[model samples]
Target chain A: AQTVTQSQPEMSVQEAETVTLSCTYDTSENNYYLFWYKQPPSRQMILVIRQEAYKQQNATENRFSVNFQKAAKSFSLKISDSQLGDTAMYFCALQKAAGNKLTFGGGTRVLVKP
Target chain B: DAGVTQSPTHLIKTRGQHVTLRCSPISGHKSVSWYQQVLGQGPQFIFQYYEKEERGRGNFPDRFSARQFPNYSSELNVNALLLGDSALYLCASGYRWGEETQYFGPGTRLLVL
Candidate 1:
């Protein structure tokens, strides 16, 4: 079974600054996918960014990027030029190539301060 | 295009009761999946249906079941509900069974007393 861990339960970043949310996972699969999802107060879960294990380059989506370290089993999300809209609960997820189910981390609550 | 849509934004039930949650996937999407998100916890996979066929199931007990329709819509049924069952039920859809991205719906909040 794969497990994802988000050590920080809460985080805050000033507007226009950057913040990084840490994530780690345990999985034996060599090929898989890592994803960061944002759930706002509206209760809608949105995909932030995704990284493929076989791809060395990190995934970037607008102001959202990921730092994926496969050997360390770490996948962290970085939000640059953060805005108030970035405030939400961020979750790290893992899915193996052979499976459709996603294993998610506890989540990190981020607050962007103006 | 509209995203995944779930019915009954909120529902309340009692122990030993039953509840049925519905979901309509994005147009042209053939894969629909169900998840339960307990307060303060990440969403847990419940079931996955592709092309009206059961493709995957999680560790949930037999009390929980789900099925997909030909239109790619789905329903999740829970029987003998327990208080522990009270949570946000989320529905997700993908273009295919193994597609990388699974778009999530707003979710139906279920409360069991």
Candidate 2:
């Protein structure tokens, strides 16, 4: 079984600034994938970034990036140059390499203030 | 091309009622997954289907069930709904199964009274 944890329930960031959200997961399997999804008021689960457990390099996409630590079992997301549209609920998810289910963290609500 | 689509953007049901939600995956996608997201919480996996076959299931009770069609569309059925069963139902689709990225639809909002 895989379990994900997000320590912060909410976060606030100024527009154009940067904010990082922390996530930690526990799983017995060595091979798996981690993802960050953004859900706006519309309730659409939008993919932000993903990191492979076996990969040493962190994953980055546009203004979104992840700090992945394999030994620590930590995967954190960093949003740079945050915009008003960045305000949303962020979720960290885990999927095993051979499994189809995605276990998710509770989530963190982010508010980007102008 | 169009992304994943789900039917009945919003619904209202009473206790003991049954509701069926529909989802159409992206074109050519063969895998569809279902999730339930209660307000203020992250989405929880319910079921995953590939090639019209059950690939995986979550810890949900037997009250929740799902199936996929040949066209890769899927439906989630809930029996004897309870007020606690109210949630936003999400449908996600992937090009294949396994480690591939899954794309999600807007989701269906269900409210149980």
Candidate 3:
């Protein structure tokens, strides 16, 4: 079974600053996928970004980027130039090459202060 | 044009009761998945159905069951529910095998008393 861990239960960042959420996983499969999801007060889960295990280059989308260390099974999310709208609960997830189901980390609550 | 939608929005149930929650996927999408999100925790996979067939299931007990219709809509059923079932039950949809970005609904909040 694969398990994802998000050590930081909560984080806070000021507007225009940066915040990083930690994530680590245990997996025996070499090929898989990682993702970051955001759930705001509206309770809607939204996809933030994703990284393929085979892709050495980190994935970035606008102000969001991931530091993926394949060997250490670490995938952390970094939010730059944070805005108040960026406040949400971030989750890290893993999916094996042969599986469509995702195993998610506990969660990290990020608060962006204006 | 609308995104994934889950119905009931909120529910209240007593122990040993049976509850049904509904979900409608985005247009043209043939995959629907269900998840259970407890307070202060991440969502946990419950069931995934594609093309009206069961594709995958999570570690949830048999009390948690779901099905997808030919129209790509879905319903989750829980029988003999327990207080532990109190949580926000979310439904997500994707066009591809589940690898595609999943669009989630506003989840049905279930409170088992």
Candidate 4:
């Protein structure tokens, strides 16, 4: 079974600052992938960033990056230089290396203050 | 070049009613997956199709069903809808299935009355 947990229900950050959302997941598979998806008021699930479990280095894209601790089963997302548009619901997801299903967390709502 | 697309951007149905949501995958993509996102929660996987075959199914009941067409388009059917069934239906497409970074559509919002 695969389970994901996002402890924070909500988070706030000022513009140009940084905010980190925490997530912990458990999966039986040895190889898998982790992802962060953002859902704004538009209700569309947009892919933010993803990391392969086997990769030792964390994955970063533009201002979005992840701190992936394989041993601890932690994958946290860091949004730097936050903008007002960054306000949204962020979800952490996990997919197995040999499976198609993606198990997701309870999501964290982020509010970016201008 | 177009991304995944879903039809009937919004819908409303009463209890015991049936609803069908459609999805069109990106060009050349072969896999499509369905998810249900209730308000203030994360999306829950429903179904996945690859090469017009059922690849995976989630914990949903028999009231939920889906099918994929030869063109890689898909439809999600929900019968005997209940208030709890109301949610945002998301469709994602990827090159294949496992380990693929799926791209999602705008989603279909269904309100069960």
> What are the runs in model 2 whose C-alpha is more than 4 Å off?
none
For residue B30, what is the lDDT in candidate 1? 89
Off by over 4 Å in 3: none
User: Against the unseen true structure, what C-alpha lDDT does each candidate score?
Assistant: 0.93, 0.94, 0.92, 0.95
Q: Which one wins by DockQ: 2 or 3?
A: 2
lDDT value, candidate 1, whole model: 0.93
What class would a CAPRI assessor give candidate 3's docking? medium
**For residues A1-114, what per-residue lDDT tens digits would candidate 3 score against the true structure?**
999999999999999999999999999998899999999988889999999999999999999999999998999999999999999999999988775678899999999999
Candidate 1 error regions (>4 Å):
none
Worst 10 residues of 2 chain A by lDDT: A95-104
- DockQ (model 4, Cα): 0.84
- Output the number of the lDDT-best candidate: 4
* Residue pairs in collision within model 4: none
lDDT of 3 at B111: 96
Angstrom error of the Cα, residue A11, model 4: value is 0.3
DockQ per model, Cα: 0.73, 0.84, 0.67, 0.84
**Candidate number achieving the greatest DockQ relative to the actual structure:** 4
- CAPRI-style grade of the A/B interface in model 1: medium
Instruction: Count the clashes in each prediction.
Output: 0, 0, 0, 0
Better of 1 and 3 by TM-score: 1
Best-to-worst order by lDDT is: 4, 2, 1, 3
A11-92: candidate 4 lDDT, tens digit per residue: 9999999999999999878899999999999988899999999999999999999999999999999999999999999999
Residue A98 in candidate 2 has what lDDT?
82
Which lDDT tens digits does candidate 1 get at residues B1-113? 99999999999999999999999999998889899999999999999998999989999999999999889999999999999999999999988867358899999999998
